[model samples]
Target: MVALAKKKEWSLLLLLAPALLYFLIYHFIPISGMVMAFQDYRIFGKSPFVGFKHFRILFASPAFLQVLRNTLIISFMKIVLFFPLPIIFALMLNEVRSSILRKFIQSTTYLPHFLSWVVIAGIWIAFLSPANGGLNQLREMFKLAPKDYMTDKGAIRWVLFASETWRSLGWDSIIYLAALASISPSLYESADLD
Candidate 1:
């Protein structure tokens, strides 16, 4: 059986060559560079190993701790709060009867996902600008003072959440839409009958 398998697998090995090459070049080669994390990296001479030195510094630093805390809090909000939102959005969208409107909505929402962060930043900067910006203009109408949220630390976290949602909602919904599509329509029919 082993001999027969090896003989039959020769063509399969050839078929896998591109993927094997990609793994070696893209993944394994770059992963090998991670050894520098344990070393004091040097360009000309050999890097000297200083195990746990960087990690100790990272842990001891107040700024690093603050960054770490912010990262964890932001990650939790994005992952826990926002994760289920796309699935719900897709489900709600699936319920819509008008294909034209549905397509329009999907396209509009998905477009922001394709935009780069720099472009998004430019757009948001303009939107949130205190002087002659959209948000401030609206605020002025309501007799409220203009506020620049870009540099405000309190506003920064909410901005992250909002931008993350804006960027990912449509793209993330696609997977859930696919899952929804895979559900057999007969199951719904059966449920209706019951």
Candidate 2:
């Protein structure tokens, strides 16, 4: 069998040709482009090798350091601060007995997940617009100062965090929702009886 396989059987390989071609085209082709990372990749001409130069420059750049810091801050805010929110939302959803209201809430929340990031960004911009945003209007209603969140350094990170959370909220809760659905109703009954 091993000798026959090594002899290149046309039948089995023909059956796998499409999958092999897909791997060659999509996977290996792009990965082989990693050679460009070591070269000054020119579109029309031969790329000259520049080993570790780009990496060194990237690491040394002050702008890169600040970007890294901001990324860490945003990640912490999104992951640590936002982690419990979906679970809490799912728990609240589980407690609600009204099927109509529950479905309504689910639909609204799930709809955001279907929207593109550009649309979400536009909505956030409208919300934070200085002159006539909902937030500014609310502030004015309370006789407080209207701050432009878009221009405010202190508020931009929060805006980013909020937008990310809003985008993922319903989608993330889906797993918990599935888990909640699978829980035996008798468990709740037993707890109530105790």
Candidate 3:
């Protein structure tokens, strides 16, 4: 019985080995790279040890501080201000009686989140490019000069927020949709009768 059980255990281990190795290579190995931020990273053998020098430089720089502030502002815009959007969308979507329109909205909202971040970024870059993007076309319509949002310091934050919203809207709205589905039809009926 023990001899037969040995191969069964080994077979299970063999099946799991690839996933375990993948996790170690991708997740655990990258953690060791955290030290590279402190030290001067080298392609050759020995990297010169510099403790907290990089961090000191990062903390002391005004540009870094400004970037940090921008990041927080973007996060707040993404999380707090953006939180209501899914609820609003779900409510609006609930009111959509035409099944075709509802499916179209759902697909448009959900599809972007499934796209690779690089692809999404490229699409956004092209859309916002000053040369002849959709946005530039709109700007031209309004007789306003086309601005390069990718390069513009002031405009980039809003671009980030917008891109994040596009990516998050579908997935976040799913929770509300699920809640809406679980709700009793009698409740809606009673509300309507009121």
Per residue, candidate 2 scores C-alpha lDDT tens digits across 27-119 of: 999998898999999999899999999999999998998899889999999989999999999999988899999999988887899999999
Clashes within 3 Å, all models in order: 0, 0, 0
TM-score of each: 0.85, 0.82, 0.79
* Candidate 2: regions farther than 4 A off: 1-28
The root-mean-square deviation over C-alpha atoms between each candidate and the true structure, in angstroms, is: 2.5, 3.5, 3.6
Q: Which stretches of candidate 3 lie above 4 Å from their native place?
A: 1-30
Model 1: CA > 4 A from native = 1-7, 42-49
Candidate that would win on TM-score: 1
Q: Supply the global lDDT for candidate 3.
A: 0.91
Query: Which is superior by TM-score, 1 or 2?
Result: 1
Q: Order of all candidates by TM-score, from best down to worst?
A: 1, 2, 3
lDDT of 3 by residue, 48-157 (tens): 99999999998899899788988898888888989999999998888899989998998899888898899989999999989999999999999999999999988998
| Pick by TM-score: 1 or 3, better one | 1
- The candidate that achieves the highest lDDT relative to the unseen native structure: 2
How many steric overlaps does candidate 1 have?
0
